[model samples]
Target: MAVGLLFLVCAGAVLYSAEAQDPYSELPDYYKRGVDLALEQLNSHAGVHHHFRFLRSLDKSDIESGFGVRYLYHHFYLKPTRCAKGTTESNPQTCPFRNDRPLMDCAVCYKAAEDQIEPSPKPYVHCIQKPRLTQDMRTARTDHCKKMTYNSGAPTLLAVSTG
Candidate 1:
């Protein structure tokens, strides 16, 4: 009986210690009060709502930068929208649109190699989605690969890493 009791105590202590490591687990008194006040105004009727696509795109950019989305957003876009929407790779002329490069650099040339893209795309946020290229433009994947590999080190592309 004593052995079982001791074991229980030890297990409880281990659990408590593990949880104690997080300073914000319960938040400080000031934070708790702030949270209470904030929640006071929040009810079932009121909510912060946004589409998953929008949030996901935002998160993807954030994760890619590994820093505050705001910081990356500011440095890259020169405002705060480029990370998710678009930023130019080289000259703002060739592949001059948002989210142009794959990864940091969208599969730009890769885009050309695959097929002609889309039609007239209206601008959204900071950048506009590009219209599909004509058939003659995407004659060969190799051509695109060449261009994609080329990086002009534009201000946006070469700026400081926010992360």
Candidate 2:
């Protein structure tokens, strides 16, 4: 009986570790978010409450759900500007982002959109603009990111930019 219990414990540990270490599980948080967006779109049944909360968030409160979809937040320019490359810029286009950590970059990104940043003290990114993006602009902007992430393996706007 004791061996059976011990075997169960060991089996559980192996399963848990395997789940944690699965190569498919290695994608960053924003990648997971992109997947969630696709899943959310596919599920179409996750309901409006969360979507409303995200849309209504004066600050994008629920975006943190991006378990591996971090890359979605990166902003690109048709032309690179003087923004420094190694620190968090209140604006990625006009400022700098410290590449020390991708999450830090994500935080800085939230600051610019200011639409979504988990309500927090000392949040890394701070919005300097009133987020003038209209609903159309926001949709366009988000779609840009989503497209890039969803079709990362395919040619993208950035690719067009560079091409």
Candidate 3:
């Protein structure tokens, strides 16, 4: 009986270690699919080289229960800006915005409009001047360090959503 119990414990340990080593290996099929889909969308929208690290299963009951599918609160680092990289400290006083205008809703807009793209919202009046580079926007500490993790290379969670 003791030998049998010991074998079971060892087996469980082995399985746990294996799962830890390859985070995606033990994910349920639906969960894996969701992560893959999200990653693809992020890559295409953000940039091919943008990095992402999975934090954890936000909620699997939806997929397990055969409800459509949703991954709520799975944390990820947005692609860092060039200014972020150039800054020396996590809490730097300021950083430069990208010189060229960056795409915002453009990708989704283009996908929806396709060849029927319309000119900029008629008359194209600027609503407000862009903030100066010296603007002291206070980034959350977690966000500032998300891509700057220690040797492990995974960002600590900045914010998580319950919904």
The number of the candidate with the highest TM-score is 3
Candidate-wise lDDT, in order = 0.25, 0.31, 0.32
After superposing candidate 1 on the true structure, give the runs of residues whose Cα lies further than 4 Å from its correct spot: 1-5, 13-25, 44-163
lDDT tens readout by residue for model 1, 1-163:
9999999999999999885453223332322222222222221123312100111111111112222111112111111124222233443222212343222111111111112221212101122112443344433422432332212442231133323
Candidate 1 clash pair list? 86-98, 86-99, 101-105, 101-106, 102-105, 102-106, 102-107, 117-132, 118-132
Q: Is candidate 1 or candidate 3 better by TM-score?
A: 3
| TM-score, per-candidate, Cα-based | 0.20, 0.22, 0.29
Measured with C-alpha atoms, the lDDT of residue 92 in candidate 2 is: 33
- Of candidate 2, the 10-residue stretch with the lowest lDDT total is 48-57
Candidate 2: lDDT over CA atoms?
0.31
Q: After superposing candidate 2 on the true structure, give the runs of residues whose Cα lies further than 4 Å from its correct spot.
A: 1-21, 45-157, 160-163
What are the C-alpha RMSDs, in order, of all predicted structures? 19.3, 18.3, 17.2
Q: Could you give candidate 3's per-residue lDDT for residues 1-163 as a string of tens digits?
A: 9999999999999998775554444564534544544544544543333233333442322211113322211222122233432233553222332434422110011100222222332111111112321223223322332332222432232332232
lDDT score of model 3? 0.32
lDDT of 2 at 109: 29
Q: Give residue 13's error in model 1 in angstroms.
A: 5.4
Best model per lDDT:
3
State the lDDT of candidate 2 residue by residue for 82-140, as single tens digits: 34223325533333223332120011222112232232212222111123335665555
